[model samples]
Target: MSENDPLLNDPLLDEPQARRRWWKPSFDRRRILRWSLRGVVALLVIAALYYPVGMLLVHKIDDDPDFQAPATPEGASRAVALAAALIDREVGDYGWPSNDPFFMPGWALDNMPNYQQGIIAALARFSTEMRDQIGRVRGTSQVDPDLEKAAGQLSYSPTVWIFDFSTSWAPTASSEQQYLAAAKTLRSFNNRLSQGQAVFERRADNLQGTLDRIAADLGSASAVLDKQVEEHSGDWVDFQADDIFYATKGRLYAYGLLLRDLGTDFAPVIAERDLKAAWAQMVETFRVASTLDPLVVVNGRPDAFMRPSHLAAQGFFLLRARTQLREISNILQK
Candidate 1:
């Protein structure tokens, strides 16, 4: 082919030129690095936008309030109301003219297990409700060491579960012995409750009047126990009397602890009432009453059949505690 031929000079026929311009790209180190830098910058921009947008969404979706806020006087009052209702219900359940007729003499003995069930249900319910209420109160109430301490003590597992009862009223000698032992335990438990009364008085300047009312109720219960022993001199049914005593002690201890704890939680609320003189009187009442023991003396006499006197003391305390609890409820309501 001649050097001047048209095909030889045509661009399509230029092999080397086509190789440089079309077959290979300008992929030098500087060009590659520049493009890489642009990619990195794009990634950085995307990350920056993504993080803040994600955080903003998270913040918007999470609306929980801080629970560490100090408690208000209103919160303290609400705590008192919750506790007072528990006290009233517990006392009323054990007192004479009980709403649950299964607790009366003939039925109570026959359906002892059922009686136990009713009491246990109430106790469990009280614990659950109190825990929820106190947790909410603590979120808002001012720091209170005595109140916290009382709540700690009261938060213990249900004490009733510590004693096991036979399914039926028909008792073997072993069952009778078991019940008497439980009765003694109940008395000792009451002593423990009496000792804890001091916790209520720890911040007495704040809780004087409410503490006083609780102490008076305790004293009345103790007095009834003493009076019962005094009036009944001769033989007594060991198991029956002890069981009755156990039941009474249960009522007193539950009532007393709740009353005292509520008093602790409601100290600020009570102080707001400005009943200084009344509170002073209440402190005195609690002090004097604390010195007096429940004076439970059931085992001294010989064993006999169950009698009205066996339950008289328990009934008295129940009634007195109920009345006092109602009064406390009224005070809180006002």
Candidate 2:
């Protein structure tokens, strides 16, 4: 028990710091391994749920065939009202996913973006026609300012996001902003038309010109379908088929609605020309084409029995509609 005792002053007891250093590293290694295992498991869990959950939250086609525009204001152009309503529904109600950023779930989506862009393209064309032909009393007359603005805004690229790296590093107006502004301008034009301050000439010639432009657009879409079918047909997994399909569907859907309302807008011309039946058939064909929502798009040969080419089927309807449009345009010329 004495401090000077040889047994109490052993060398092992005097070097406790060395023992502590040896054990400390072992403890630290075990702690690091445990944390690393937990980190890996957490990452695995996130990776497992990231795509499926994100896709569920973000994916929506919104291809409602029977979608009706808000009731047109009395004395306002029905077609203008429909155009504005379609833009509002897509941008505000349905949410524009075509311009989603890389971090968003929609950025990974292909079909929906194609479909939405298709819809916008059709609307842009319609707006251009409105500015050039429908909104003027004659070719020499001044263009309506609101219609010109709407046409320009609607024609903006659908793929632009809040920041466009290709053109500029700074922030820019997004596709949604541009489309919504177009919608606003369309509403303004409609308001002015209702108040007798704007021109929406519903003459037979204007209707014929509008139909001609629309038929030309349909011809182009049909050609796209034709090219896709001709090249990629009978592939078991044709990746590009769905993109073309949905884009065409979106275009047809928008045109169907627009032309339907335009029929009401120019009913007097239609009745006078006795082209009501042909116009109805054309709209019906577009309706059928727009509603072709296959679970999987197959680019089978046009004559293949087992895997029929959806593109070919869609082309059939597209061409039929285009033909009907031409027939109606001819009748209006009489």
Candidate 3:
């Protein structure tokens, strides 16, 4: 019992201190493990809901074949107004999904992105035609500054987000921003057109040339469909089929609307050339083609009995529309 006695300093006397140290560490570890597991489970629940809910909210494919643009102001080109309206509806209203970052819900959407990009592509093509042919007096005439700007902006890559690491590390314009700019420029061009300060040639030759260009584009799209059907037919699950189908649908839908309005714009030419029936036929063909929506896109063999090839069906309509366009162009030439 003396202060420095060896017998009094026995290891057993320190048992309470040792047990306290061991028990404190054990309790702390259990508490930390329980909290870590709870954190992991909470993250899992959030991640599980993130994409599904996000996709449900963000996914929209507005393939309304009968959709019409709001009426243009008096003297404005209806086709031009329609183009601007389409751009606004896609980029501003629905939100351009093709350029969304991985963190966004739109990034998970494949069909909507492809479809919207396809609409933009068609609009870009039409703007080019406007700048080069329709919006000018002749081939040698200077391009309209607004139309030219719109064309260039609309042609910007649809997949570029805020940052394009391919070109530079700096933050760049997103696709939606470029498209919105294009829409603004298009409206500017239309405003100038309404004021008679811009040229929108309604001559027969100009109409013929524009229709010819659209026909060529449809031909190219048909070729793509042909290739896709030839190569990937009969797959149980054709992942690429839906992309191609929706993109083509978008293009056809846009072209159908534009051509419908352009008919009104070129009414004098269409009437003078005795092309009312032909023009109507071509526009109707585009309308019908644009409305072909399948619940599921299947790339079945063209000759398959059980599964039908939607691509082939779409190609048939595309070719028919192109042929009708060519017939109308021939009549316009005459």
In order, how many clashes per candidate?
A: 4, 0, 0
The whole-model C-alpha lDDT of candidate 3 against the native structure comes to 0.88
Model 2, 1-334: lDDT tens digits are 3567554456666545544544564458788999999999999999878877887787778877677777766778888888888889888877787888777777778888888888889999999999999899899999999999999999999989999999999999999999999999999998898899999888999998998998999899988988888888988888899999999998999999999989999989888888788888888898998999899899999999799899999999989888888988888888
Question: What TM-score, over all chains together, does every model reach?
Answer: 0.30, 0.91, 0.90
lDDT of 2: 0.88
Which number leads on TM-score? 2
What local lDDT does model 2 show for residue 197?
95
State the displacement of the C-alpha of residue 188, model 3, in Å, after optimal TM-score superposition. Answer: 0.5
What lDDT does candidate 1 reach at residue 64?
14
Q: Which ten residues in a row have the lowest lDDT in candidate 3?
A: 18-27
Error of 1 at 55 (Å): 66
Displacement of the residue 37 alpha carbon in candidate 3, Å = 3.0
lDDT tens string, model 1, 22-64?
5465569998899999999999998666645643432211011
Q: Write the per-residue lDDT of candidate 3 for residues 20-94, one digit (tens) a residue.
A: 554564358788999999999999999999998999899988877667778787788989888989999988999
Alpha carbon deviation, residue 17, candidate 1 (Å): 99
For model 3, state the Cα shift of residue 64 in Å: 1.3
lDDT of 2 at 299: 94
Model 2: residues >4 Å from true position, as ranges?
Answer: 1-32
lDDT of 2 at 259: 93
